[model samples]
Target chain A: MDMGKGVGLVETKYITVASHPHELTLESGQHFGPVEVAYETYGELNQRGDNCIIVPHALTGEAHVAGRHTPEDRVAGWWDELIGPGRALDTNKYFVVAANVIGGCCGTTGPKSTNPETGKPYGADFPLITIRDMVQVQYLLLKNLGIRRIKAVIGGSMGGMQVLEWALMYPEMVEAIVPIAASGRLAAQCIAFNAVQREAITGDSDFKGGHYYPGPGPIRGMGLARQIATITYKSDESWASKFGRTFSSIRPQDYYSLDNRFEVEHYLDYQGEKLVQRFDANTYLYLTKAMDLHDLGRGRGEYREVFSRFRGKVLSIGVSSDFLYPKYYQEEIHHFFKQAGADSHYWELISPYGHDAFLIEFKKMSLKIAQFMQTLS
Target chain B: MDMGKGVGLVETKYITVASHPHELTLESGQHFGPVEVAYETYGELNQRGDNCIIVPHALTGEAHVAGRHTPEDRVAGWWDELIGPGRALDTNKYFVVAANVIGGCCGTTGPKSTNPETGKPYGADFPLITIRDMVQVQYLLLKNLGIRRIKAVIGGSMGGMQVLEWALMYPEMVEAIVPIAASGRLAAQCIAFNAVQREAITGDSDFKGGHYYPGPGPIRGMGLARQIATITYKSDESWASKFGRTFSSIRPQDYYSLDNRFEVEHYLDYQGEKLVQRFDANTYLYLTKAMDLHDLGRGRGEYREVFSRFRGKVLSIGVSSDFLYPKYYQEEIHHFFKQAGADSHYWELISPYGHDAFLIEFKKMSLKIAQFMQTLS
Candidate 1:
């Protein structure tokens, strides 16, 4: 098992994958060739290989989900709090694995990843992927690791989408699933936010239709997109308290001109510029499109019939202030499970951090999740 | 008496210089040239010419404040609500006059106006203007119209800024003032919002640095800027009740595929595109920047000292829900007036419409305004 990035003091064997040839046959009867999957593992697989936990990441998250295993990279793992020694998932007892989604900027075979055939970045040449495709790739990764069943499929946000897919696609292969701060499908507001972000990128002259890498890549446009995203990620109440009527420099140098002043404006600029450095514009576009297409049980027939595919226990968590994947979405999930006759539990966690509550309020949330998982025994 | 746009149908007299020379030396010590001003007359000026009431316009508002008497190009006025008839400013009793400012696109010499020197659109060649420069041009326009002492100065938003400037610049010529939904000085947050909007326009590749006319002129970027402005125009509670998680698009067009689904996405796109048709991107930038530089007290010393210049009766009205120019801004005016020993009345009107209440809640606000003006008797 491999320890994750950002966490220190852990010992584990890391599962490695060779550059194996990958082929994906899509719903359109089309086939994609020369695919590669990049993933990292933590903790250890038990004798039955049934103690494994899987985490799917959000739009920008990489495969590094738990500890700071890479000494050179100093950033903390995305889920450092929930998966560690004696923590929520308790890496001491259960194995954990997280993969960079197939179409991501990370090491996964995404837009940023090189096309083996062309010897250049896939860019827009990569076909648009659905959530089902991502889940299928993760399943292949698990098979490569010799794991037949997952003790629990767990994730939040986009990660949570994968958790739902795992439960439905291979019911007996997953005993329990925890989908946190996620929705069964992308609502109108979510799609709207993503559209604005995409416009910010596509409208930029530097974008070049997602092929402007090696040169400048619409950083300002991408920043504006991030600015829009930043607004939805947090609550309005947060902005009121943080900015209000604060003033700023009017023309940069004038001290007393009373010009170009407002704290919210500065905050937005900072948010836009910061995302430009850490994220790629094309990746943002593709991942958001993936999120917009995510619907757990849409194809199997009615929502009830689709949810009935999963016969295992399920735990769904939502944050009170998460307007993105709101509590109402979680309520819908609970209703679907109940109607499907699955033993499902739904919990709401109160936090003022908005959609980011899953990460910030992880202490209380982690305890609840740990307790729920222990009940699976 | 002149008929303001929406005011009572009165036959007003006006003359267009058609070739009026504009341009003034800015406080920045730069010479700006080739200017124009559009004006209309209400009741004839008395022999002493002291009954004149100078009415300034707000953001995006033209100086057609009353009805038009000319049969050639008849256009209704913008302020038909508060002028003419037995309304707040009875035209029969007072000599009312209004003029389009120097930097406005409405009939005045602005960026869109042909530069007499070059006979081409001024575009960005127009010198950057200060609020003081705008007031000075209005002063020049009034001088050319053979006006001396004025009875009063009134306006809201940008117009409010002019009213405050008139009081400070030519206190003795003003007898009374009404400033609605205005601020003492532009705050930091206000400036920041304006800055971001300007950035959005100039950052667009199609903007051509304000020269993209006869073409689209970065309409998409302008639309995005307006969307941002629209968000600030209304209160948080209003948006919450109006939008919530409701689908933004009533008809799903499948514009981008299943990945780009949502009503809010479509709503914002429609709104952003709609604004580009009605608004000029450069004009928007210039006007917002003017508002950013509007501070009657800036560099002129203390705010109280600036208020001391207004030796007249003052009435300041603010809307309770107006976050743009909050009620506290009204209180600031009231405080400054009290310190200056000027007779002043301040009223806060409770309304849910926010900054827009000044325009919508006329019934309640007009009563307070009329009563205050009567007290000046």
Candidate 2:
């Protein structure tokens, strides 16, 4: 019942797939076996088993999607605000499911996962996986759960990438898809930022080429990576409004000291430290690289051809201030869906929170998702 | 004269200031002595010595403002296109001087410079300096050159910060000021990027608390910092146009390989390696810290009050794509100059190069600078 720090919802469960001869061959031609997926479910599956809704999570997100198991639990699931009985996800009406993707650290098969072959932690030996691979793993999990067609699959950012993949790979399985703050292909700037973060992790002497686990690990590198990522996650307007040029109250009034003088610096340092405490450095590397390799059209012929196969209604949402996955990306997806003559709707969330708006401005997102859900009915 | 890689024009000169017993007191109340400044001059000082134009270099810029001493010199001075004969700066008509800043590595007294007291490098012991301190050093150099007043002072980015400082700290001495692609105060996002870069350098175990000079210093960390910074110096539009999601031609066609996939990654890696080769990591820390402390109205009452003291024609130019020092920042400077009722003009350079447009896209900047010079006359 304690659930521990970063442990997902109290009801979170695990399913192991691709064990032994059923090894999952990745897009890179490498295979991983006995992959474990941590997930949580809410509400009822219903008689028809068609009311299930899968929710994929963004980078650093866990399997927990709603509710706290223990009374002393300080944090609820990430989507606790929107996945309750009367919320947008409306657990009373829909059976909601959220799963930690492969390459994630939170009880999911990742760099920290043990390799059955070597009887050692995979570490750097974890085969590179893609958004498609993650979606395939989720599909296998859903199949093993005895679910065929899902009512909807909703996600944002990297989760959105998974949503896109789900619609493309298993078009007949999902009735609706909501991909928010995501792109068919990540922009060059986004890739650049991710590349730098990977460099920060690898450059650390503590990283030891991603084999630094079972020890203190590359905390400094991971912390620095988190700091860089936190900057891209928030908009300039958001930072200006929240911190501005205000100096930290605790710091001395030394004019040109190297110590954190600005409140923003202090905030970033805190964010970095927070991530280092909870996140694994090797997992960070693997997952970010997976995000960077997310190109839907890769190995696929034309994007229009790919979208044309999807029978589900598409609801694409973007944040106006989101630079990481800009509004244009969502628009592009909408355009492709429209080109295919598929039922599609595009909505832009105007917020100063940047790429993080989907998580922060829940009211607007909740309204949109609820409206989209009605169309699915 | 082979001036060496990254060295300024052959005509560059040096002058030692703040020698022993006359140590320069920095904004942080720390003192440093035997400070040497490297500078280069174009054209002659007129009989009245009033044809001088002191140009302050940016964060990584050197004293090279124009021309090459030898025809075989592969790289000309940074602003060579704008500061030559009949050019924007018009070396034929006006004397132009560009000096390396106090905390700069290029022939200036910086962290790499030896401490007279310790007889070793200053390294981390180098006193924290501000933009005002840099301007003061240039002021001393000008005084040593027997120049009472200059025709104008011109700079962009960090150089622009120095231009504002020079006008405010010595109003009567500068006749005109041209600050391009700069801000009165660094925005929170800028500070955040700088903080990450500093963390990267300091986090390097090889950094050795900033005393990693005269040996293999924090090259990897410095490289990573430069990689992060290179992204900021460019616009998303530019990166898309130049590199896009194009894969590196040399890399294998493996779908999910960890190697540099995109051309942008290769470009960033090249930029990082280039900086690590020539630059001192400790100097990078000092100079970036100086930039972060740049506040025109730090000790001064208000922004308007600070601008009112500058009796000079102000021409503020901004790159339309510059995110680091956005056009909005330049507009703010122009606003304050106009509020003070000082002669001011604002121009925006339409370019995809972003913050680096001042260095690239020379033709447009050249014409603007030429027209502004005519107005000054």
Candidate 3:
């Protein structure tokens, strides 16, 4: 049952999906290229090559989908428990590949990558990319690796957006998909949340127009932005259950000062501080913008037209307590797919973790995914 | 149907709830006094001086409850829709009074007031006050005005917190209470939201340790804080319906720039900018802290013990779409008051305005409040 021992140690590999000067024309009419995709693969692809499954990571996630980087690594990949041999994806029976999306700040080419034109990090110079653009990059990676037909593509949050995008763009190549806690088009409130987060980052005096490459680079603003994201990621019920009026410490004086912390405040600060240490603020800005602009039917006609192109089987998983991407979006995904006469189903996972339920409520999510994967045949 | 003629022009008046040298010991074990309460009245006190309805204003609200400050004033008070002659409170039939809470920046004695000890603005030096302390000051105001009792105490959001506090503190003096979108004790998530808003104000470089008087006083940070508040004040469905995918303007370049914004972001910036112009950053810090510290049973007893002392009739009004203070809190308020054997009824207003429903969906809220008021007579 141990995922680490089950999958063993894994190594991340990188490939330039689009070599320099060979631009990948994006959905935004911008030519972005020399794109790199960092990914990890588990299990053999099999002789027929029909057993491949793609795992896409969410915002702020890297290409590592399961297993430890090294035997000594303390943390496995984000979806370690839900993947691996004998698990939902069942690495023993299927070949799985998880790649970092374009415009990501991992081992992939993103705002942090050097611009061929200037020899400096792209930063805000990175062109705005959409969910379809990210899916295109994934397609390039798969094609380069000679993995033709996908058994299924699965992910949550931004990853889920990618999953749906893949099915829409390549219904013939991908057979099944599971999109969890994603939106067809982001709600106005969600866009507003993203807007404020970007505002905090840019509002910081240290932001330096996204050119502060060597300096600390808007750490405080990014921290505040992360804090806001953390608040929305979880359910109000979960926060109440976890932190509920508790002071940060037993110190009496901490209760009287504005600077003093609540237990929840301390948790948020830790989350903020942690992300700021590893993330580039410009990437945060770009990725959030991508999310804000994530409309499935944009430039692609109406909902009926968008759903008509996809004939893949779908399992849309929604989290009942999700605040950011409510369960309704997934239900909408299923409803539209069904209306288009495509094979589609939806399961709203009842949880207290809000939009983060897919990540935190691993056991429940694993069960649902495993049941659905079993039916994929 | 003309609200202007219904209530007519009204003037705000101020009274010192506590004179110099007469310190009111606070919940924090700090002595804070010489407190002034700013208020406005409509109609007249009856022969028995008991036909008075106290309208406790919410956070960032003022003593101006209804009517215009001047006949030519562009905007009426926050609750002008529900407080005119033929409205819910019905000024033609009942005397209605609204007071600014302490720690507020309105006309009340708050962080903006001059501290007698230092002869400067209190700023963050203002003692950490609680909902109970605000209620106590209101009690003093009624006593000084020679009004013996309140026919009912009504409010929404923070005002609702005050409504609950009034019934708990002086049960014999307040005949009835209507707490809309309030909590028995604030949810931990609500406290976390307050914490972040305070952090933004205090984290600002120009805050100068909360003594940024004579300067712009953390306008950027306060603006960001207000923007965050505005998002929470609205429902997701409302935002989708109101500003979905709309650009700030018709500028073609706005679609490509991170600095350029969506229609929702533009609206939020306007809200933030407007608030920063009128509000003091230090008061924002102090008032939110007071709210975070609001606990019905704090320094008193268990909720059952506290509610046992209040015999006032209760009408707890919940808002179905309120993000900040969800309807569940109001329902919880009703549950506790009823369990204590107090005359309590719960009503959840279904509106898409979220927490702002009480302030915006006035016709629906009016029907409920007016019916409740009718029962009181």
Candidate 4:
């Protein structure tokens, strides 16, 4: 229960799918191929290769699920707290694969990836991707790695959406799915948030129709988008406790200037600026689209029917203060599983961190995740 | 109760305050002079002069509270639903005066107003005003109108904040005050939302340090700011009901394009674009600053002590699902009144309209306001 940083110095590995003409037909009926998936694995694959958990990254996350790439890499993986020896995923007992999704801009192929045919970065030519397409790329990567069956697929936020898709796309292969802080469909307000974020990015004169590469294009817009998004990721309680109208130390005497920063404003500006450096505006646009388009029942029948058809057990967890994906959404996902007669469990993480509780409340999340996995064993 | 615009056509009137050297000192110790307040009045002043209610407008709202400016105007005032001959503010019973806040971009003198000191628009030179300063401006306008005692002050959102401030500033003149879907002080999240909005406006390259006037300046930035503000204004239930995952009718086949719009996104864009035509970015920045600095217990002691000192009766109202201000905010306001042993009533308007419920739920708000008024009579 207290395993910490046991998965050490894990290196990212890459594999290609839909090579040459991308024989992969997208959900949009379009053919896109030659996708490179960047992934990292922890623990060993047993002879049966059945004890493997796939850790899907959330939006803006990379394939580093645990451990540091180098001793000086600053910090461990994004989910380093929950996926290691004796941890929630318990790398000691199960192999774990974490991947950068198809439309991501990390080491994976995406809008910033070079197009094989044109021999240039895809840039604006990147196809609109769906959660299912992302799941499909992972499937191909798994197939190539001889990961014929996954013990469980676990993730939070957009990662949770991928977990849901994994259960639907490869039911027999995924024995269980733990989707945390996710929704069957994006909420209208969420879509609106995404719209404004996109607008902020593209509204920048330097955007140049999303071809603003080779420069820090639309940094201000991306910063604004991040600031907006950062607001949704944290709750009212979190902000009140952390900031609460406290003026910033930056020129404390200048309250009359429009440039005066509230502590919260400073936090938002800092976050926005920090994110733009490691992230791309084009990828942000593409990933949000995938998220907005994420629907468990899209093209498929009702979520109840689709979930009922899946043989895997489901653990849909929600953070109580997650306004982005409200707690009710996780209940709806669990309800769909139960109504469809599939094995289901619903758990709410009582935290004020909002959508970010999944990443912040590691102890609570691990405890619940571990308990849910025990039911299957 | 169904007055049905009985107030009829009303003309907006203006009054000046803080003439030279800004005889009025702001909470920031800065002197802001020659503030022209735009206001509209309903009903005639009764012989008792005690039957009057001062209405304070929310951010971006003008003083025209309950009637059409022109017979040809498409719609009546913003809160026309609750103020008329037989409405909540009932012109037949009580005189109601509504004024645009000092930082507002309405007919009121604001950032867009010509500064008599230099014969140029204040632009960014507008002093940082607080809810208290706004109340002072209203007091001046009322004094100019030869109005004395007031029956009540009622407003929602930022209006509600002013109502709270009115009770504190002029405890004796204001008898009863109703603050709906408002906070005693803005929540940190609300401040954060305001921060990003200000960021969006100022982030615009054309903002040019807040002097981008006469050229339709920062249209995109203002649009983005509005889009963000619009999202926070409504509740999740309202958005899902109004525009759940619906695609826009604009070129449905081109979902792959980054330019593709979801119905909700289109709605946000439309709202953002529509607002820019009337509102100025500098005003948005200034007004949001005022709201951010709105703390009921700033220079005063705790809210409990402040309310304890005020002799006014308070009817604090909250919408059930107002996430921006949150219903707990109203509860907090009511709790302060109770803890201070003051005459107070807390009424929750059952609404999924969120912070906007005060504006959208007219019938319920009217009925509650009428019921609250009867106690004083």
lDDT of 3 at B248: 71
Candidate achieving higher lDDT, 1 or 3: 3
Kindly report which residue stretches of model 3 are placed more than 4 angstroms away from their true locations once superposed.
Answer: A1-5, B1-5
Write the candidate numbers in order of decreasing lDDT: 4, 3, 2, 1
Task: Name the lDDT of candidate 2.
Answer: 0.84
Q: Give the higher-lDDT candidate: 3 or 4.
A: 4
Interface RMSD of each: 5.2, 1.3, 1.3, 1.2
DockQ of each model against the real complex? Answer: 0.16, 0.68, 0.71, 0.80
TM-scores for candidates 1 onward, in order: 0.69, 0.95, 0.97, 0.98
| Model 3 error, position B113 (Å) | 2.1
lDDT of 2 by residue, B1-377 (tens): 11112223467798987676347887767766778899988877888878999889888889977778677888888877777667788777788888999888999898898877788988888788889889888988888887877899999889999998988899888889999889988888888889999899888888999887688998888989999999999887888788778886564656466653677888888998998988889878888888887888887988567899886899999899887887988998998988898898899999989899998988888777788899875
Q: Write the per-residue lDDT of candidate 4 for residues B1-377, one digit (tens) a residue.
A: 46445688889887776677567777788877777788889999887677898988888788887888788999888898888877777788888998888878887778888888888888888888778888988998888877899999999888999999898888879888898888988878998999888888887888999887666788888988998999999988999999998887566577766667788887887898889998988989988888888888887876557777666688899888888988888988888887887788899999888888888888888888887888885
Give per-residue CA lDDT, model 2, range A248-267, as digits (tens): 75646564666646888889
Fnat by candidate, in order: 0.17, 0.80, 0.65, 0.86
> Once model 2 is optimally superposed onto the true structure by TM-score, how far is the C-alpha of residue A311 displaced, in angstroms?
4.2
User: Where does model 2 exceed 4 Å of error?
Assistant: A1-10, A249-253, B1-10, B249-253
Candidate 4 stretches greater than 4 Å from native? A250-252, B1-5, B250-252
By TM-score, rank the candidates, best first: 4, 3, 2, 1
Q: Candidate 3, which CAPRI tier?
A: medium
Question: What is the number of backbone collisions in each predicted candidate, taken in the order shown?
Answer: 39, 0, 0, 2
